[model samples]
Target: MTENLPFIEITDIIQSLANKRSTGTLELSRDGEPTTYLFFREGMIQHLKAPRSQVILGKALYQLNLIDEADYELTLSDYAQTGRRYGEVLAELGLVSEEGLRQALSFQAREDLQNVLTWKQVQTRFHGSSQPLSDVFSESDLEFELQMGGMSLLMEAARREDEWSLVREHIPHEDDVLRLSAPGAIKAEDLEVRITLLIDGYRSAYEIADAAPCNTLECLHQLAELVREGKLVTLEPLELIELGHEAELDDDHEKALKLYQLARSRGQDGFDLRRRIARAHHMLGHKQEALERWLEVAERCAEAERADLAIATLKEVIELYPTDLHLRQRLVPLLVANAAKADAALQLRNLIALAETNGESPQLLTDLMNQLLELDPSDRPTLKALATLHREEGDGVLAMGRLDELATLEVEADRLEEAILAYREILEIDPENLNARLRLAESYAGLGSTDDAVAEYRGLADILYNSGLIANSINWPFLIRVYESIVELEPSSTPAWEWLAKAYIENNQRDLAISRYLGMAQSLRPTPGEPPSPALISPLARVVELDPTRLEVCYELAHTYLALEMRVEAGRTLRQLAEEALRQEDVPKARSAYQEAIEIDPFDLVSRRGMAALHELQGDLDLAFGIWLLCAELCQRVGLLSEGRSDARRALAISASDPRALKVSAALEALAEEPQAAAALLLRYAEIMHERENSGLALEAIAQARRLDPARVARHPLLSLLSTGNTPRSGAPLR
Candidate 1:
């Protein structure tokens, strides 16, 4: 005998007996359920006896048409009196032949095995009889003729197990009753007549299988098909409750609640039913219906004086919604009404703590905390709340003491932000509380508030510095590390960068100081369209001071100067950048630097000359002449006539016949009031244009020369061509 084996072990027990060729009866049983027996002869199944719910042999024989209903009833009565098997009685009366008896017996054994396989747990016992098959039951009983191979029956059971999963989708449970959805809608061929006759809205699928001609799996499959076709459906209320129970057993609370709610809509109601529904809702997660149902059950149980039940129900809800202040408050009074003083006090304490932390109104929280304190004066959470109230009321001296205590508690609880806030309050009450500030800083750093932490650290450093720690260099390294963190958090913090740099220098790591500044400047590269950052200035300037040949650094420094409206300094920096770039033979870099310098101060003659020289080096004569002319124009505008004349001469030297150069040169000479020199330049300009067939331009130039010096223009050779109307393709009109 084997006890408490898993349901799957039935197959192993059957196979082991078959392999051993043991002749015995295997009894399968579960607690609170009927036992099933399988009789084997030479390891082949010959007979089975299962519960009436699982197998009704006479009804199965009648349903399979092996015997008529009359024959089934007649044989059952005769077999009872004759002390013979029902099938043997049927065969004796010729109601069912011997072959029919064997077939019915085979069907019974298959049904029994299938049902046994579906059970979740079982106990088994094998009684080895050691008797011949004919002697086990008399030859007249015909048990010897009804043998089935054990392995083949087990294989059939396995197939049914697989198909049961699919059949279960529509017919969720075997005990679920199925009925015609609309009697007129069901056609004759849609379902077998025998099965249809059993669908009286009262019989379960398992019962229908026993009373129908088909096996259990086939009957279930047919019912599922009818369900899918909408010709049949599981009966409501009863079937829903059954399914709910099944789901509940499976711990599928959501499905159980759905099915139970469906049953309630169909008029299934009771106190226990509603309580079960409430529990399902609670397990599935709350809906308003679930909450109301739970509340109703709790109230009913409380009125019934079932305090334990009521308390347990409320406790379940509270566990799910711990911070629900109203729920906790309600639970507290319920515990008190139940005379559970210890539990009541614990709940009250929890309520007070929750109110304090759950952002309840200040008045309500104050009342709760005061009540808790009255009962238990040493409650830490209540004390913390009172201290917070004192701080808010501006009782600083009293608040400071409470806040220090609160901060320590919060730190131990690992609530770093709360601890930081408490420490901040302490510092507010006593601004020079270095200990509080230090704790606050450390907590801030722990919570990733690096900038805030560094700010507090700097405050501490300042307090110490004013106390003359800096004179002895006692905390200089501390000062350095603090500033390093500050800059690390915000690389572009100007003051932090300066402090770090100075700290590095005092530590005699000047190169490291320079590297830090350089790193800072690199991090501050300005995005396009954004205003230049002020923080970029000192770092870039420092880096430039360390190595002036850092042209890119110098270039950014120049832009920062321009942003600050320091035009002279910007121009100076750009010039330095251009000189350095030129020394490196980077013509493009030098050109850009000079271009920026000229943009900052349009009349910067030195940058203009440098740009002009770079253009000349790059074989760009036109650009060179243009820059020279622009320089001369700027000089004239600024009242530097000699400088203007020199720039103009430079332009003419680049392109002797270029009209723009000649015009600029003439203008500069006129600005210097040298009429002859101006006239000569204009005449030269006119001659070059006339030779290029630009007679109109030439005539305009001659007109300008005449304005400068009329006598010199009259002596020009172009004047004779203008008089002859031999002006090229276009006639010229002198202005």
Candidate 2:
């Protein structure tokens, strides 16, 4: 199907054909351009041909200095005479090697495809064929034919088009002249530098494009980039005049002077132009005729309601005649009435600086400060000067208030260092200001001034700690910084050390946390022959409580608890250590941990079970079975029937003939609503117990089985004979 380029972009069409694995000759053409044919084999681009252009393989080779002009001419002559392919002739004559010819042809094909891809407006059609056609060069001759895929071509072309658009923005007209502004700004080997050397003041962009070493589009794109980067300047006809007029209108006299100099080269000399030029010089602080011209222009601009332009015209005059107080008087009211706060502030600051130099009255300075404040309430420099002025006027409260406002504004603006200075000024007025001190500390920390932050935090800690206001609160992050700084300053302080250890844990510094915790433990250790403080137990225990998986930390906690003679805590810590070890499958470590727990609390059944489980994992069935039996018995004594059943199953797994395990299993079975299975298990258990000379227990087991299914027991010959002499009731004890 035929497709329009705009509706489906050329890249999308190419991608679609590739995805469909279409094999055919795809023809692309644009109006007024020769048709280009692309041959595809199994969706991969095999070859491409375009109407002959100067950028063909032979010319490319010559341009790249790979083949001499003589060789190129000779090869062409040979091809014309023999009617052979150009690359084949080049290969046959050894002007270029087979590989070199293939490479050149590949480059030629890619360049042809790239040229086609840049066609913004084109028509496309695919001509399907059942059989592929043979071209000038066989596949064997050009084994390295361009394999540029659809996606790669799309990306490259899109990138070039985007860059071309940006370049066009800078060099919009082909008639624009480009000249180098900064010859030394770019490297000598840079493409921009080479392009810049080609630019002369008289050559238009179109002429430069024709003379470029590469393709016309690429050369134009490079020239545009150079213009945009300010390395090159585009000089269109009358641009200087337009710029000069613009500067003159904006009252930028300095810029106007520069523009007018270039504009004058175009023969723009007239009385009115010379007069404006003189006025611009005068506004730049020049003399005599310039000064007269500037005064006239300033008045004319003012009458035209262009106050900004008039003010610009007068600023230079005021600089040349600083003693001209009348000129200053004229500019000040215009500045204020125009609502030009920035310009007014500058003029007022200058006036104040001049007055202060001349020893002007304090009231005059106060008035200037008030004017600056009215212009911009949050102006930092103005507020700073106002604070100093208010303090000198014996208004300390007002001065401190201004400093506080300045600090707040600075903080909100993310000007951390500026806020720090403002807060320092506030503290200077009231050294005991807690809020200012705290803000200063926070700002220091925000700016990564760690040592300064630490100092401020230590000072705040002293104040808060002395007031008894330092307690655990939701503001733990702030308190953490305070205590951390305190510990750094007073490493031996017990409270600070304790709190810092907790802080480290809270901050997720696992390594530092363990170290700090150890330090606290050592500091809280009692002297020889003295009982450790009960308070020391909590921090030591906290280490394990924070991360029970830290087996080493848990071990240390247990040892410390033992040293403190806190037996119960010691046992608990060891049990936690053993549980953590078992969870990690560290059998040897678990064994040791459990053994220690048993030493601390010999009746710790959890530890005993852990040891048994460890033994079971090590394949020691006898030991495992013994421990499981003991656990089962203890659970049964405690009325933990489910746990007893679980342990009994473990023992039965080790030895199916064990009477105790069989009895527990059978009872559990009965509870589970499987009387038939329970009775069979009990009958087997009674047999085992009787064989072991445990007749009473055996009879008890048999009676339990009978209670489960009396009829089934009566039919079983062996069980009936065993119970015949006893004739025991369901509730009777065999013994």
The TM-score values for the models, in the order shown, are 0.33, 0.33
lDDT leader: 1
Tens-place lDDT digits, model 1, residues 155-230? 9878877788888888876666677888665777887776788887656777787677666667788888888888
Model 2 ranges with Cα > 4 A deviation: 1-490, 505-508, 545-549, 562-568, 582-586, 664-678, 690-699, 715-717, 723-735
RMSD of 2: 32.3
Clashing pairs in 2: none
lDDT of each: 0.76, 0.73
Q: Report the number of backbone clashes for model 1.
A: 0
* Model 1, C-alpha of 324: deviation from truth (Å): 35
For all predictions, the C-alpha RMSD in Å is: 24.3, 32.3
- The local distance difference test score of model 2 is 0.73
lDDT of 2 by residue, 27-144 (tens): 7887879887777666778767677643666755654556876887876787779877666767667778766766677666666777787676778877775333455334543455
